[model samples]
Target chain A: MSASTIIFYILSAIIVGGGLLAVTARKIFRAAVFLLFSLIGIAGLYFYMNYEFLGAVQIVVYVGGIIVLIIFSILLTAESGSDMKKPALSRILFSALATIFACALTLWLIKQHTFHVNESTIIEPSVRNIGRQMLSTTEHGYILPFEVVSILLLAAMIGCIVIAIKIKPKT
Target chain B: MVITGVCLLAFLVVLCFFLGYMERKVAAFMEIRLGPNRVGPKGSMQIVADTVKLLFKEGLTPDGADKFLFNLAPFIVVITSMLVVAPIAYARDFQLWDINIGVLYVSSISSMAVIGILMAGWSSSNKYSLIGAMRSGAQIVSYELSIGLSLISIVILSGSLQLSEIIESQANGWWIFKGHIPVIISFVIFIIASTAEINRAPFDLTEAEQELTGGFHTEYAGMKFAMFLLSEYINLFVVSAIAATIFLGGWMPFHIGGLDAFNHIMDYIPSSIWFFGKTFLIIFIIMWFRWTFPRLRIDQLLNLEWKYLLPISMVNILLVTAMAIMGWHF
Candidate 1:
């Protein structure tokens, strides 16, 4: 394998392994911490793919913001540090089966697609280029989706506020 | 790979002394007292002495903590900081990957610092550790929004995601100058948001000694604790470098129209020095904020992010985007 491919494989392992640890760990805080690592690994992949802005956003937003929120929620809930009870045998078996099924579905989908991007296409990392492409009428312009991202953030903020605010007790 | 490895080692070795020296000097200047004049010319080798002390000290694993993660936390903190430096535009053509998504890469890696904090907090298995970790979670998330909005404004103005492109776009004049009022506004918001994001003073409730008692890493001792301390300074360095690269123009020489000889002279200094000079100036400012301001209450911190900076930056971004489209800027 090429050096880049080898690097890719290693980061992929880290991302996947960290994700599993985040979800499956017995302690809630440990899970949250693992999620942070997983997100960082994915950002590394984005950097390797030449998507610098996306990588930084991934760090600033998801790894930095979202996981931090999760940690806060764990803290506020009062259940963060306790040892969670292991699932009963039958439930554990059922959950394991479900996980396998989900993994299989994803693996099957990955196998079905043959992905390719032209290797000769050169690009600049400038915000100016992205802005131009965004506003352009061609295939590379991403203007429409940019507005969508804004709306989505607006919705997220509203939802977070709603979740955070508990109605005051009636006088 | 070999070069990158060497760079990481060099980064750590330099940071060991610089952070140690900066902390002593800043603390001394803050209180009307002198600090750290004993070791190696104004405590230059103080960190070295400290390192030797920590090296000989015994490693302690507290009872009831998860053994595996406890060991993993410090290394993770150092490694995450190391990884984020890759995409930073050290100078013109001196960056690692000048990718279209450079901004995203930086934003993502920065978040990992929070994870390291979480690890230190939880793995310590103390009540203070838990509280500190929780506070860090809330603080980092809230500050990140304003940080993102401010950065998005830069993306709007520079019209590029690459670090090199961002620096190049400001070649004629730094973004703080060339881009309209909104860019300057965003720069201001960004600096504040980043200071908060990195848990510097005025936003350092996570380590509030009066409250959580050393905050998240309270239970840590020896080299593990040292790693946490080292990571904090490295983070300060990384964030300042980024702010300089994005807003101040990384290693791009000053260019006022019709001043060739002076501008050429400005370019004579090594790119790395120019980069470090700009970065350290910002670092000093951050340190000033730490000493000058008192820590914000957790509620006040969240309110500042949500009710103020976020909204202002969003509006500014819209204005800048419209201006960019209308050809209103140089």
Candidate 2:
């Protein structure tokens, strides 16, 4: 096999293994760390595909932002050395069934669609092009969705502030 | 690629050693005391002796500590710092990777250092380490936003995320000079935020010695501790180099629109020299701040970022965006 293909296999192994460990790890902190590895592996996949911006975003948003927050909460709320409570047998069985169904459905969907490799139409995903498309007013532009996402984030921020702030008791 | 990587690693070790010595001298000068005179030529060999001592010392893994993570954390921290050097242009035509999203990559990779710090803290099985790591996590996370926003202003001004292109855009003049008020504001904010992000003095609440006692790496010993110290200096260099690159212009020598003779004279300096000179200048400024300012209280530190730097940077981005669109910048 070619080096690129070997690298791809290794990355996939990391992703899958990390995901498995994240769920099965006895300690919560270790589980979070496993999730971090899984996320980083996904970022590696993005890099492998030459999606540099997307890869960086994956690292910045998920690995740097979300996972750190998750770990912070874990550290604050849980004892690091303690083992997590095992899920009930019924819950495990149901989850296993759900996973199988999801995997089968995904495979079926992939088989139904034929992906065309149109070399001529493939544009270099440079930052300049990304920026132009993001803010462009034309039909293909993502300005509307971009603005919508911003508004959604703003609302979330306000909600978080509201929830976090404690009113002082009357003297 | 392998050769360059090896060379860069070697250079970084030497640079870190020099910085260690420099920090001591700077600290000594500020405190009106002689520092490191016992070693080679006014304590110039102090860091070397210290490194040797650390190498010979044992790296202790405490009882009940998470051994796996404790061993892994220093490597993670060191590797993240090393990774950020990839996109940095040391001189004209002297960059390792001129990736399109260079700035983004630097910010993202640098952010990963906090994970290592967190790992170090959590795995140490010490309360002080845990508290220090948590403080570091909160501080780095909050300051990262301001750093991103400040960098966004430069991206808007340069109209490219590529480092080489950004430097080229500053050929006529540096952004701090060309982009005027907004750029200056962002520059100041970048310096302050980056210093805090790197956990330097005034913002070194992560390892606040008085309270936390060595902070996240409290339980570390020997070469493992050295790795943490090395990473800190490397981070200091990285942030200072970034500040130099974005604000002062990477390897571009000073030039003026209507001053041909002066511009020609400035170009006489080598591109690499220009780059290092600017970087070291910023590094000195950071070191100066370390000596000058008192360590900030945790609440005060959080308040400075969220309430002050964050808002100013957000507004600065808008101003920079307007300037970029209006073709106002030189």
Candidate 3:
């Protein structure tokens, strides 16, 4: 096999192995750590695909920001030594069914699509192009979505504060 | 590429030795005491002895600790720090991988160190480690805003995220002089934020010895602990080099307007020397801060980032954007 194919297989193994371990791990903290490994594996896949900016974003936002947040909350609420309680049989069966359904859906979709491998049509993804598209006002621009997301985040922040702050009762 | 990787690894080891020794000497000089004078010629071989000792020492994983993760943390920390070294241009023609988004790449990758620390803390099953890791999580998340925004301001001025282009823009004059107020503000904010980012003193709440009892890596022993220490210095070196590259002109020598003769004389010095000289100067300033200031309280630390550095950096970004729009910068 070619080096790229071998590398792709290795990366896929890492992602799958880490994901399996994340779901099956007995300890919550270990599960979280496994989740981190899986996320990093996905970032590695992004790097392998030559999405440098996307790979960096994957690591920074998901591995650095989101995973850290998850671990922080785990540490705050759960004891490190305590393993998660086993799921009920019904719950396990439902989850297994859901997983199989998702896998079948993905496979069906993959079979339905005919992906053309057009080498000439593939444009190199540059940071400048990414930046222009992000801020552009054209039909394909992301400015509106970006602004909406920022506003949504602002609302979330305000809502969190409102919920967190305990108003003193009338004395 | 393999040769460059091996060479950089070698350089990292050698640099860490000197950094460890220099940090001690600086601390000693500040505190009015001699530090490690007997190891070898003013303690030059002290780090060597320490390394040897650590190598032979027992690496223990606590009974309650998760074996895989407990062993994995230090490697993650080291790898993240080393990955950032790729895009940095050591000299004019000396760069490992000059990626398109060099500045953004460094900023993003460097932030991943927190995960290793968090893993180290959580897997250890130690309360002190957990607390330290939690503090680090909050601290990094807060201060990263300032670090990122300050860098954005520089990126705005240079109009390129690539390191080489940014350095080229500073060829005529360093950004600290040419970009004027916004650059100065961003530089100051960057230094402060990055110093905190690396978790040095005055903001080292994570590893606050007296309080947290060695903090996140408290359970780490032998080479594992040593790796953590080494990555800390490597990170300091990387951040300082970036500061020099962005604000002080990477490998470029100082050139005044209408001073062709003087500029030519300055060019006689090798580019690597210019790069390292500026990097070390910034590193010295960071080390100076370590020795001069006491650690801040956890609340105070967060306040410094969110209340002070973040707002200042945001304003600086706006100011820089305006300058960039109006063509006010050199």
Q: Count the backbone clashes (under 3 Å) in each candidate.
A: 29, 1, 0
* Per-residue lDDT of model 1, residues B1-330, tens digit only: 688768866865686578668877887898878888888887777878888898778778888777777888888887777777777877667776555667766776677777777777877888898888878877876787777788877877777777887888887888877786888898899889999888889889899998889998787778888787777887888889889988888887766767988878887977778888899889888988988888889899889988999889889989888888886876
In terms of lDDT, which candidate is stronger, 1 or 3? 3
Residue B49 CA displacement from its true place in model 1, Å: 1.6
DockQ of the candidate models in sequence? 0.58, 0.84, 0.78
TM-score of chain A of 1: 0.75
Q: State the lDDT of candidate 3 residue by residue for B182-281, as single tens digits.
A: 8998999999999989999888989999999999999999999999999999999999999999999999999998989999999999999999999999
Model 1 is docked with a DockQ of 0.58
For B259-308, candidate 2 gives per-residue lDDT tens digits of: 99999999999999999999999999999999999899999999999999
- Tens-digit lDDT string for candidate 1 (A1-171): 899999999999989999999878998878877787788789789878866666676777787668777766776776666878887899979988999999999999999988888679767755556666778887767786887899999999999999999999999
Model 2 misplacement above 4 A: A137-140, A143-147, A153-171
lDDT of 3 at B299: 94
- The list of candidate 1 runs beyond 4 A from truth reads A1-12, A15-24, A33-62, A102-171
Best by lDDT: 2
Off by over 4 Å in 3: A119-121, A143-147, A157-161, A164-171
Interface RMSD over true interface Cα atoms for each candidate: 2.9, 0.5, 1.0
Q: In CAPRI terms, where does candidate 3 land?
A: medium
The local lDDT score (0 to 100) that residue B98 gets in candidate 2 is 92
> How far does residue B253 in candidate 2 sit from its true spot (Å)?
0.9
